[model samples]
Target: MRPSIAIAGTSNSVMARCYAWVLSNSPDFDVVNHSRGASSSTVLPYALGKIDLSQTDFLVIDVLNNEENFVLLGQTTIEDVKNNLCSALDAAAEHGVVPIVLSFPRQNFLNRERVVHDAIKAYCRELGVVFVDMYEMVEDAVERAPVTVYKRSFFDGVAHIKRPISRLVGSRLADAIRRSFHSDRVATSDHALAFDRIEFCFPEPEAGLIERQNGFATEKIACLGVGESIGLMDSFDVVGIAFNSEMTDSVLSTDHEQVISLKGPDKAEGRELMTVILPTRFRSSRLTVTGEPGAKFEFVGYARHTDDRRARTRVARRSVLPVPEFDEQFKKDIALLAVT
Candidate 1:
């Protein structure tokens, strides 16, 4: 059977849609993508924990660009981003899947610091996982052509490359995959223990967390009126609230000096909004969520992604090349676009 490849990435990966588009055309692999636009690396560990990757062989992760955005916005730190990457790697190891970390160029490649991409490379080396650096690839491609032309024709000049460049990149990645095949290597227990395991707890409706609602009710959905509050006593990296398909604003406070303001979906329709208290790391912490005034939304069940230290890892019987190097032909094809 052909190996299966899965993607757990951010908006760039989704917007490019290069990997899946190119890989699916091949006869050697089955592809699936689990990516969300406008999301950062903080959410990947939570997502990987929820997604079923038991049948997956290779997992590609690309969130450096988004992580950089968060870092620049002062919402998170480099250390926290690295820790999130570690947690994500640990989650991938649970399924005994080979993980490839893909790093893209920063939006302002010429001016911005490469701290996040450098950190990603460092983590990939430390964890013994594959690392693909598309930043260098794009940089080299631009050198072959005028920067303005490359920016106008190929790149969105922000975060994503155009479809043509995306296809070229995707094709090169597919070629690399075809060359190396699948890896049987997984992270060691000591490696996995280096990070905290993410755990979620969904409170029961009868738990008295919130008043049960009559309409649009489920075990997981509790209703909170304006100024209503719910509390959880435990160790948690973050607390999540599944608000109804309505716009609401809430605040999450920890026993320590931490208060997180959360906003539900902007629109009054669509899926339930799952917002979390972030930039937090507290143990045995008491958490409180209070709806602000005019907060009219179903509480849904209260949930939290707590950090748990557990030691578990799979043994690797063999190893394959982790990084994918583009062939001469692939390099030539990318360069041809410069003059064409």
Candidate 2:
């Protein structure tokens, strides 16, 4: 028997041509869409009520476009989106519905959607639902063809994806849904939404350094000054460090700062993944990651930072890079950093 798939969200979800593409390509798949072209707050309740949960083997949702737009314009609060989404998920869970979630794509790489994605990610992690990390998805697509972003925008003010990107997004999501259905794995770390935790950081005192965020965090990380850096004050275990994107200038790790380099795999675009790592042992040595504009640095594993007067900054800081979610769309055979 073919698995029944139900698609729901606002225009962003339903407008992607991927839905029809998936149905037409997979002869054994049964697909139904319950999404509409308005704000999710307005459309979601109705979409949920109308969907036949009994027949839905998988219910895939596209979050962000509706919610993000609302939050950006002050039409809705992030809290309201969270509350309404959680309520919908609760009802889906009660009906034995297997939920698969996704966030819509963006060209400018806004964190507005990341807020929505994170909201759903937290709930889905608790419920063991699958989230197709859209940030990672589009990042790969953008690297392939930067113009793909335009295809993702509203077409003729219809709030729908263009034909080309629609096909791409749809086909990819279908594969992800099937794989997620079969793979019985749930992301254990808070990194499920792709935002790496700050093992240690020098945020402005009382400026705030939260690990998880649900709204527009304009200043998530303060940009470091020339020759100034942030790092572990005392030694702790560390597997790797991620140098997230939008960097116009390169960041350097001098030989003296020997935390060792745990390099990540090459991206699909053949761009080297900019990560620093060390081999299989814990060192008590301090590891400081310097920063420049256009890049966000995330240190992996437990580390420490001295939160003194220096930790506090007069200047506000935020990440120039977009949210760093896991790049799960592409599959590549690669090796991990081999440490001594």
Candidate 3:
């Protein structure tokens, strides 16, 4: 299936004028732009909340934002901006949403050491988020056509970037999205989750430390059985809809909370291993797993992946020609380790 991407940009019309316009012509993508003009970093959370993450595979947010109108005017602080961005990231992860942050085309304004972009970069690297560097893209454009860039101006008045430049950015951004879909990103820890995968070794239960939420507790699994199936849901987002019968009295708790609970159940024999993950700006919260009723199962280690890791790693072999081995006889003392 063709992957989808959502554009969550703000004023200055970069996404509207450039990225969206270019992507509109591409058949490989289905773009949903939620960009609003005159919006600032302060409105990011609200802006993100409006996006219907379901049926959406990727989210695009811009960095190196407009410095003059937003930051300098005190619409938001560097710290608050980070907080908002981090929150949105958490929401995205819950839905298996991949966020690709686009770089600001230029440092049109410099406010507070450019910490916004720096923080975003650090978070993306930590979380394995895809980042497309617009600077390099723009630099290549200018270097290739210095005269045209300076003469006609790549931008259309005030801040809107011309459609041509936007199309170029969109093409590169599309390529990055495609690559990420077919690639496996690494998550550093067992409790870690990435856009590509989430895995954690099941923790052993203690006598009095098994925490429960609304009487639902996730237990460790040893193996899965036939006819057993697993699915994911976010309690925080989906409410009032009866997704499954098992969720009754179910609660969402972290590993730390579960591990620190007073006691564990006597048996986990009938429950299947189910894992639900929601990654954050720093890292994701703890996961909870449950099994389908009437299934002969017991929970074990949990794992979830968007793509098969092995399939993603399948590399096409290039036919290698045999190289002749060199010997002292063949060298014939012709070569010497000499400065001459």
Global CA lDDT computed for model 3: 0.42
Of models 2 and 3, which has the larger lDDT? 2
Give the range where candidate 2 is weakest over 10 consecutive residues by summed lDDT: 331-340
Q: Distance (Å) between predicted and true CA of 279, model 1?
A: 5.3
Q: What ranges in model 1 sit over 4 Å off?
A: 24-27, 145-154, 182-193, 200-225, 230-233, 239-258, 263-293, 296-318, 328-332, 335-340
Q: Higher lDDT: candidate 1 or 3?
A: 1
lDDT of all predictions: 0.57, 0.43, 0.42
lDDT of 3 by residue, 1-340 (tens): 7877677665433344466666656788887765543344433443454467777777777634553334555533554454445555666665666666665544353212555566667755665555554444444444454133441244445445555555545665666566655655412221132222222223244312222222222333333233423333222211001111221223333434431111122224454222221112111233333334433323322222223121111111112211112233312211121001
**Shift of residue 302 alpha carbon in model 1, Å:** 9.6
| Top-lDDT structure, candidate number | 1
Q: Which candidate's TM-score is highest?
A: 1
* Candidate 1 residue lDDT tens string, 280-331: 3444344355555655544443323445654532322126554566655555
lDDT digits (tens) for residues 1-340 of candidate 2: 6667776665554443444556546766687765534434433444564578777666666656556554665544555454444444555555555666666655443433456557666755554555666555544544544233332332324234345545555666666555544554322221122211122223444423334221211223333333545544344333223232222133435335543332332333433222211112234444344455553444322222112111111111011111223343331100010000
Clashing pairs in 2: 18-170, 194-325, 205-312, 219-318, 235-284, 261-277, 262-276, 262-277
- Candidate 1 C-alpha error for residue 196, in Å: 3.4
The true-structure Cα RMSD of candidate 3 reads 20.9
After superposition, candidate 3 runs with Cα above 4 Å error: 12-17, 67-69, 110-115, 140-152, 184-340
Pairs of colliding residues, candidate 3: 208-262, 208-263, 209-261, 209-262, 209-263, 220-299, 221-299, 221-300
